[model samples]
Target chain A: MTRRRFCATLALCGLAPGAIATALASEGHELRLGLTPVFLDDQSIFLEAWRTYLTARLQRPVVFVQRGSYREIVDLLNQGQLDAAWLCGFPFVRHERRLRLLAVPLFQGRPLYRSYLIVPAGDTHTKSLLDLRGKVFAYSDPDSNSGFLYTQFALAKIRERSEVFFARTFYTWSHRKVVEAVAVELAQGGAVDGYVWETLQRSHPQLAARTRVVEQSPEFGFPPFVARSTLPAGDFKALQDVLVAMRNDREGKKLLGQLNLDGFTPGERKLYDGIASMAEKVANRP
Target chain B: MKHFMRDLSLRYKIPLRVLVLASITAILVTASILFRVYDETRNDLLRHAESMGRLLANTLVGPITHDDVWRAYEIINSPFQGGSLDQTQIAETILLLDTRGQVFVSTQPTQYPMLSEPGRLDPEYAAIVDLATDRNDVKPSVVDPSDSSRLFVTIPVISEGARLGTLVMSYPKSLFMPRFVDIAQRAALMTLLALAVLLPIAWYWGHRMAKPLVRLAGCMDQIGPSVPENLHCDLSESHDEIGRAGTAFKRMLKELKEKEQLEQEIMASERLAAVGRLSAGIAHEINNPLGGMLNAINTFKRHGPDDPRTLKTLALLERGLTQIKDTVAALLVETKVEIHPLSRRDIEDTRTLVTAEAAEKRLELIWENDITEDLPLPSTLVRQILLNLLLNAIRAADKRVECQVYRDSRSFTLVVKNDGTHIEDEDMAYLFEPFSRLSRNGHGLGLWVTYQMARQLNGGIVVESEPGETRFSVALPLQEEA
Candidate 1:
């Protein structure tokens, strides 16, 4: 519904886009995706819409299982319960070894977005993630990139220099929720991916009415669509080609627009390899 | 033991039943109030405690989430105290813990076991912990050791797959503590107020009741044959039992006083009547002898010149004659006197009349009845009544002068009083009866006839008597009716 939540939900799915390749290659295979947002029993019938879309393309039944957060997506992918997911850069970095990228989302013509630490328009204390120590910090999702992990990565950078981040951290669950948290003063400041924050400010003024961007992190790849690493190599390449050429076909372009992604690129694992390496470096350094 | 016996033996006293009822009622009412108040107060205390705990936990949530761990204690103190939390009056401990088992804050940290040490989780605590992890939706709840109905709430801080800490609070269930306690206190106070008001009313009523009995005793003390007048004691007009009894008792005494007065009046009238009848006849009878003595003395005086023997004989005769006259005079004085009756005259009135009452007692003659016939229309009843009294009187005259009867129109009045000391009021009432006498000289018949004749003629009588004189007057009704 909201860009921030869209990103979080993308991250909530416990698999990567490449997993579709494996499902396509294997006969009698069941296509599965782990969605991290909780599924209430009321959504059982409504989820059939997603099943229909996936089944028409794969010529098989596509199943969706809900998890509470992207951490669960990563856990599920590692456990092989998920074949693919639409995931944020943070958890992708953590479990990239177990996932494969199929597509990267594009906003304003680019696949890069920065994390912004936002404060209420009148707040005077915090200017950056590093300055948030002993002050309230709001994160959209613990597994979110711009909402949490990137800001956390900024903390990771400080920790590299032997410093701690904010004195306290709280979860807002989604990008929209994070901005809402700052607006409502539930937290002093919030961190969200830059594109999602701008998009939310334009769409939901009440959520952004009391907030302003105080700081932003270095740009990172936008949340990417990925499959689990266990998907077959040939099937992975076919899925990649199909996604990349999507903008050229009318139906494919509509699908790409529906998913809010620019045409897919001939993705090399190298772009995400560095994020994984950085996370490892941060985890190891601490 | 004395006090116990006093309380127990109160049964014999008039107010024992009232006392027992009052004591039992006071204790029963007070005890019931005390018990109810105690229970309600306890419950209210518990409810207050839980709310206080909630406020502290909610306020502290901000500081914990912000990681400003130290400010947590300040946050709690202000809210718990500022709000209506009275549970601080009781001993309690508040604790806050972080995910790493680090103690963040506590109100009375000293009361708790060392926070740094990992305390052994009882089965329940361990279960709650496990529940928080699997499902973040499960809120941390409260525990109450004093009452089973405790309440609590918990909030978990989760960020990026890491657990920050848990906010746990516990308090008792007090539904009616303060309100019910107030009620009990009020009941006790009300009972006391009722007693304060009621005791005086009861005493006043009791005093009213006792007053009549006390008056009865006082009146009894004044009693004698001629009792002094009784003092009036006021009592309630209420128809309550005591008032009714008092009214009735006063009425009885009044009746008795009237009866005594009536009896006295009747006896006095009878004695005066006796004296009346006696004088009229005695005055007439004594005149004859008195005339004879005068004639004989005159004759002797005329014939006396040179006869010595004759003179001597004459002197002897004169002396003898003078003695007889003195005897008659004395009889008249002694015969008539009025009577006075006392409240104690019951025994006196019963004694029969006798004669010569004054002479036997050595009394002097002070007055004599001088009337010969007291009625305009003379009756044999009056004549006989007179003779009976004179004969009786002659025997008792002793050294008194002779009596004479006198008469007049409009008043057939008669009186004969002896100078000899009159009989006491108690004895005079009996003097006119059949065999009664002031002394032992005669039987009682003389005054009985006088009494009967006076009454038959419908005459009224009156008596006046004291130490030196006794006088009686009988007024014959012969003063024709108009």
Candidate 2:
């Protein structure tokens, strides 16, 4: 028994301590925030600055859990591993029962953005989603409102299925990649977030110059910061307060500039009503 | 090659050799420098790619573990962004291979799809997978495949003693070509500049150095077994080796000239001695009989001739016999002679002796005497020399003869000139030798006798003949008898 206990203690010393520390960190002192590649450009620097800001204001260590697609972040947030996440409108409306809207990012002073239909700069005839029929298309993500749901909702209004409307389609999993696909002519057309395309035009003008915007969807609620429904009320309120008050702080405003955002607001649930209706329209299409 | 070089002229040989040696060294040095620069650039490019691979590998471990292809792509694509427009990206494509040897992510995702086998992507990557998947030691390796134009660097991504993935970065081999070409161009320009500066100096120095040697060689080529009297070497005055050699050659030439002069003098003396011996022998053999004949002629003139014809014949015999004795006496060169100072009258006497001969040809005779005092010379020898020259002049004259006598402090001089036809060049060589018949009148012994008389008096005679004038000049120096 003595030797067995010693071996068990050795095993605990070898491996269990790190696992225990990680578990305790997520539950007690650390806030694990999920980030999907939606409108984030220069991910590491922006994530680092946001983490520093949140850690200082909320008085807790902030850990940003970044993922390639919205599905991963949504899954983590629903599983309660992530306390909160910045997610697209479509995913938030679909998972509304498990997530709560913490704050809506203000882009150009409004908690609203639109989907942009883009084609190669030489494609002058493509002006609407109907004109992109039978062409290869790239979507930023399957669960994004601006990149996928809005285009599907528009197609559904004309009684069309996306798989049948476009000859081929693929997910680039990032809004910047959707713009890159259309810019390099890898895709004849693409659906991307309007904010990402506009930001890219400002930062990477040469890359954006190769692409042309054919259509802009009606304004929908911007992708918002949300918390898990199971998160502690104190932590949720603290995160929402920190995000909403970012415009009032100098360092927070600088970070918001880096993120190409005006500020954040505790927007109403009706702000995402347009995305909810689009998701419903796409899903209910026979 | 040695024989060929030996045959080349110094003018071309020196510069050619210097240019050849300099060109060879320049080519070798330039080639070596270019090679070194090429090697260094290639190594630097490869080292840069390797370090990039290592950094990407470290950064991609988290993204690869989480299956975040976007983050991995951004990490690999970072190097391609924000550089100058002219610069090409060093890493052409970067791939992240899972522990199962499948490409989990790639910078060129359309080309190398995710979850594809590494071998399916590229045959070279098949070998790279094995090197990268070495579990014991996951060291970074830079691979330059012989069959590809790309250089590959593989860094293994590890997390806590576990091999997470392999990061493979490929770089085009032509990335360093621009740098190498720049180095080569600079090296080539420097070599050409060096040659441009060095070649003309070599040519000018070669030309300057070879000039004197060429002159010396020309002087040497004119030499034979016998040296010439007026050989001149037009070499520059220098104290270098070739100049010293020229000096030695000139000294040798002088010695040879002196030796030749000595040899000619010895031969002339020997010939004179032989002639003296022969003349003495002839004089001994004929003087007694010639004396008896002359006595008989005188007796016939005084005692046997009473008829007019007989008297005329006796006078003719006496004159003929006296001429024979005089001719024999001329042949016998006298070694011992009574010395007497030459007076003005002796020279005047010579002019008088040649006046009748001059009249026979109807030649005008001009005589000018400038002597005021007696000259300390043998008067008989001086008078004989003067008379012989004047007679020869008269005989050769076409129109007139001129005799001039002068005395300076050191010597008494006589000049006789006549308007005459020029002597032939072939006849001039032996004009003073015995038995050289160069004229239509009188025995050729007259000038030979005059030459002998001048030598006996330690005087000299010269003859000049041209188209219109012929002159004979004699100079007799005063010497006190020992």
Query: For each candidate, what TM-score against the reference?
Result: 0.45, 0.51
TM-score of predicted chain A against the true chain A, for each candidate: 0.73, 0.90
What lDDT tens digits, residue by residue, belong to model 2 across residues A13-59? 24323644575557676788877766753455455667767877987
For candidate 2 chain B, which ten residues in a row score worst on lDDT? B81-90
- DockQ of every candidate: 0.02, 0.06
What are the candidates' C-alpha RMSDs? 16.2, 13.2
Candidate achieving the largest lDDT: 2
lDDT of 1 by residue, B226-246 (tens): 545745656556687756766
Q: lDDT score, residue A39, model 2?
A: 70
Q: How well does candidate 1 reproduce the true complex, by DockQ?
A: 0.02
Share of reference contacts found in each model: 0.00, 0.00
